[model samples]
Target: MRVLVTGGAGFIGANFVHQTVRERPDVHVTVLDALTYAGDEASLSDVASAITFVRGDITDSPLVDRLVGEADVVIHFAAESHNDNSLSDPWPFVHTNVVGTFTLLEAVRRHGVRYHHISTDEVYGDLELDDPAKFTDQTPYNPSSPYSSTKASSDLLVRAWVRSFGVQGTISNCSNNYGPYQHVEKFIPRQITNLIDGVRPKLYGTGQNVRDWIHVEDHNTAVWAIVERGQIGRTYLIGADGEVDNKSVVETLLELMGQPADAYDLVSDRPGHDMRYAIDASTLRSELGWTPQYGSFRDGLAATIDWYRANEGWWRPRKDATEAKYATMGR
Candidate 1:
């Protein structure tokens, strides 16, 4: 099988490429990434010799069509996904998320290739911190930020294409992901790198926002399962049932890194922050017979910290700029 991974240099997509090369040596792999600030070729360094890597934008119809035509399957993971960045500027999100998906759908439809979409649980908006409900496949679309709204729009495009155009594809809306290769701009990596620099971690607002965290490896594993066995046109939710509040997450990081739990600073929160996000991954688990290997959030976090500590060279270059952006937002 020849697989095309869009945004394959980004955090989750890079990890997916690595896993495929490691476990499925017979499969030919081609990666298409824009190499944005969020996508780093260095993340795919170890597998550099194993796969074909193409640095290009997905919205380029000719490039996308040529690439999608050559692949047996295309896994779409590209997006402008930082909520804060989308809040400040939404055009990039719409172009990349919505228009890019449309471009891919058209190419896949023309080539008769199987396609899979990677999305997020943030598309369901937020559940109240006190709410007992979790996001399910049956959940309604209620995106809050420009990021989630555009993602929701892209997802709708895939569904419509599958129904009207008969494009063979599946979709998975996953929860928060944390692991190596993740940019320092994200929550888990940012705090881990801050503590590595002997800087206090910054908590936004009262730090009560909750997220369902899953290791990147587990999310990628589920993606592969869906690619192999999932029903076309069906949407799957991928999660590990790892839920942690922002405050507790910081404190846990402090404890794991041998610092006092309260050694972090509080900052103003971003606008349109969602209260909580949780995923019901029962479909991925029961229907596809998949389960998370990182069942414990702390254990997964510890492993992530170890990776950042052991590979400072990879994330160091981006640290200052990321913090400066957060500082401007007073977060």
Candidate 2:
């Protein structure tokens, strides 16, 4: 099988590439990436010789059409994903997320290629901290950030293409992901790298916001399962039941790094910060027989911390600038 992956150099996408190359020798993989600030070719260094890499934007229709035509399947993982950055500038998010998905849909529709879209739980908005409810496949869309709103719009575009144009595709909305090659700007990596630099971690607001954390490996595994066995036009939520609060996450990182639990600062929160996000991945589990290998959040976090510590060269270059950007927002 020949697979074309969009945004394949970014965090989760890069991890997906690595996983596919290592496990599926029968498959030939081609990566299409824009190489933006968040997309680093260095992330794919270990697998540089194994796959074809194309530097281009997903919004380019001719390029997208040519790439999508050559592939047996296309996995769409490209997006302007950071909520904080989207608040500052939403146009990039709309262009890349909304318009890019439309471009891909048109290409896939024309060529009759199978496509898989990666999305987030943020599209379902937030649940109260105490609510037992989790985001399900039937959850209503109520995005709170420009990032998520664009993602939601893109998701709707995919559904429309599938129904109106008979495009063969599936969508998976996952929760927070953490693992190697993740940008230092993200929450887990930010706190881990800060502690590595002997700096205190910063928490937004009172640090009560909650998220369902999943290891990147687990998330990618679920994506592959959906591509192979999932029903077309169906949406699946991918998670490991790893729901954790921001405060506890910071405290845990501090403890893991041999610092006091309270050795962190509370910063001004971003606007429209969701109170909590949880995913009900029952469909991915029971329907497709998918399961996460990382059963413990702390164990997964420990592994992620070790990855950043061991590969300082990969993340260190971006650390200072990322922290500076956060400082401006009081995050």
Candidate 3:
């Protein structure tokens, strides 16, 4: 089988490509990536030769159309994914997440190919004060930030295409992912690098925001299952069923490193930060017979810390960039 993985040079996308090549030696994989700041080709260094890489944007209608026509399957993982970045400049997010998705959907419809969309649990917004926040396939979108709002809009576009054009496809909304090769700008890696550098990690608000955590490898495995055996026009929620309070996650990482809780500094929260996000994975489990294969929240935190400690060169430069950007914003 031939497949096209958009954003294949990014964190989760790269992981998916590596795993796909290792598991299915016969499958030919093509990657289309724009190599944005967050997407480092270095992440896929070990698996480079096994797959074809194209540096291109998803919104380039002709390029996407041609790639979609060539492959039997298309897995879209490209987007401007940082929440703070979205809050500061939403236009880029809309263009990549919403417009780019529409472009791909149109291409798929015209070409008649199987497609899979990688979405996030954040689109469901924060849970009510007294209610559980686990989002299901049927949950109404209540996005609280521009980043999630655009993702929600993109999800709607995919559903509309399916309903209108009978596009053969499936969707997976996953929780916060943490594992190797994640960009240092993300929360987990940013905090890990900061704390280890003798700098205080920044905690937004009271750090009470809660998010379900999944290892990238487990998330990629779930995606592979859906692409292979999932029913068309269905949405699956993928997660490790592990939820961690932001403060507690930071504290756990500190403990593993023999550092103190005060190793972090409390900063003003991002605008419209969702209080908590969660997801119900029962549908994915029953339909795909899939479950996570990773450490729990606490154990995952431990493992993540060790990874950052061992890969300083991979994260230090990004950490410096993050600090410079944050410093300029503060100024």
Candidate 4:
């Protein structure tokens, strides 16, 4: 099978490429990525010999069209995904998340290619802190940030293309993913890296914002399940039922790293910070008979911390700049 993975150099996408190359010998993989700030080409270095890599933007219509035409399947993971970045400048998010998706949809529709869209549960805005409701595939989008709003726009575009143009595609909105190769600017990796450097971890607001977490490997596995088995024009919610607040996460990290639990500092929250997010992945679980491999969030987090520790070379280069940016934003 010929598989084209957009943003395959980025965090979750890179892990998906690694997993695909490691596990599926029969598939030929091609990666299309712009190598943005968050995207590290080195993430795919270990698997460099096995796949074709194209350093290009998804918003480039001709490139997207050509890549889509040659693929048996396309899994789009490209986007400007950081909520804080989106808040600082919404234009990039709108362009890449919305226009880029449109470009891919046009190409896939033209080529009759099987496609799967990777999205975020943040598109459903956030739930109340005490609310028990979880975001299902049926949940209406109520995006709270520029990043998520653009994602919501992209998801809607995919849905419209599926229904109106008969594009053979599926979409999955996943919860927060933490594992290897993740950019340091993201929440989990940032805290892990800070703790590693003997710097106190910083928390936004009161550290009470709840997020449903999943291992990136689990997320990619679920994506494959949906790609191979999901019905066309359908959407799936992917999660592992791992929900924890920011404070608990930091405390656990401190515990794992042998530091005092209260060593972290709390900073003022970013604008429009969502209170909570949770995903109800019952449809995916029941229909596909797929389950998350990471049974314990703490165990997964420990493993992630180990990755950052053992391979400082991979994340160290990106660390200072990311923290500098955050310092400017006071996040």
lDDT of 4 by residue, 186-293 (tens): 898999999989999999999999999999999999999999999999999999999999999999999999999999898998889999999999999999989999
> Can you give the lDDT of residue 189 in candidate 2?
96
Task: Provide the RMSD of all predictions against the true structure, rounded to 1 decimal.
Answer: 0.6, 0.6, 1.5, 0.7
Summed backbone clashes in each candidate are 0, 0, 0, 0
lDDT of 1 by residue, 131-240 (tens): 99999999999999999999999999999999999999999999999999999999999999999999999998999999999999999999999999999999999999
* Residue-level lDDT tens digits of model 2 in 113-226: 999999999999999988999999999999999999999999999999999999998999999999999999999999999999999999999999999999999999999999
TM-score of each: 0.99, 0.99, 0.96, 0.99
Candidate 1 residue-wise lDDT at 206: 95
- Poorest lDDT segment (10 consecutive residues) of candidate 2: 322-331
User: Which tens-of-lDDT digit does each residue in 116-191 have in candidate 3?
Assistant: 9999999988885357657899989888888999999999999889998999988999999998889888888888
Worst 10 residues of 4 by lDDT: 322-331
| Clashing residue pairs, backbone N/CA/C < 3 A, model 4 | none
* Residue ranges of candidate 2 with Cα displaced over 4 Å: none
C-alpha lDDT of residue 132 in model 4:
81
The reply for model 3, stretches above 4 Å from the true place, is: none
lDDT of 2: 0.96
Cα distance off (Å), candidate 1, residue 102 = 0.3
What does candidate 2 score on TM? Answer: 0.99
Instruction: Please give the CA lDDT of all the candidate structures.
Output: 0.96, 0.96, 0.88, 0.95
Off by over 4 Å in 4: none
